[model samples]
Target: MTRDNDTERRRPDVRTSLDQWLDSRRGVLRKGIAASTAFTLGASAATGAASAQQDAPFGAVEFQNQTSDGTTVVVDSAILERGGFVTIHDGRLFEGQVTGSVIGVSDYVEPGGADHLTIDLFDVPGAQFDQSQLQNTQPLVAMPH
Candidate 1:
């Protein structure tokens, strides 16, 4: 994972920039803070800046560590400046970096915010990687793309 320290927050025109932003921060779940909180807020703020002038692309996701049925995940909130999707990963924090693989993904969301969003797990058919159901004991990350 990489940290985006750039003070100038410009709207990215490609998915790679969003990927970089999502990978920018990785931290252990601390008391009162979710692991993906920083990135979520950062992404919101970055896109918020651009939105101030126009309808700029933005994305943010925030959720608490919670129990799951191993078949789905419910995100507390997700905001996409444009149409996009959210992904759930079997993420773990190692040396302040996240490492894991995507395990689930939500269907295409319309441009706006969603709460209590439930995403079905491992529904991709003929996937090349492991498609096992999510585990309750597994650390997870909810990322918007």
Candidate 2:
């Protein structure tokens, strides 16, 4: 009977200790969940900010050309001054050219963004302009925009 009374006396202390351990574990778990949630929200905010910046508009270029064969070449801002010339598998290529009465064959100026140049040509003699002729040719400006 004495032994039973002693065990009964210790029951409340054991229960209190177990309860404190569980509460401590729950606090750690809550902190972990909070940290994870904060990290996720921060990453989402950064991605949203980057996407908004990318959505802003940039510079563009336009090209207008007329060939002697009566074929009009109207290249949009994307195709004009694309760093290199357009080439075909058969070895035919056309680079940006500048000449009198070429309509819109002039160096491009981006102003704030990247600088690019667009040279429009009119009345090209042959079926197409020779790509090799533009090789190692430097533009009037250093930036070529």
Best-performing candidate as measured by lDDT: 1
Which residue segments of model 1 deviate by more than 4 Å?
Answer: 1-56, 92-100, 125-131
Best by TM-score: 1
User: For candidate 1, lDDT tens digit of each residue in 1-145?
Assistant: 2345453355455678656655654322231133333433445665564453343345777878788778888989888777677777665343344324556678888899788889877774454455457645877777776
Predicted structure 1: clash tally: 0
Candidate 2 stretches greater than 4 Å from native = 1-53, 68-131, 134-145
| Full-model lDDT, candidate 1 | 0.62
Per-residue alpha-carbon lDDT of candidate 2 for residues 1-145, written as tens digits (9 for 90 to 100):
5999989876778767767865784543343333323432444566675664344233232323323222223333332122322111111211322121122233333344232333333323343443323233222211111
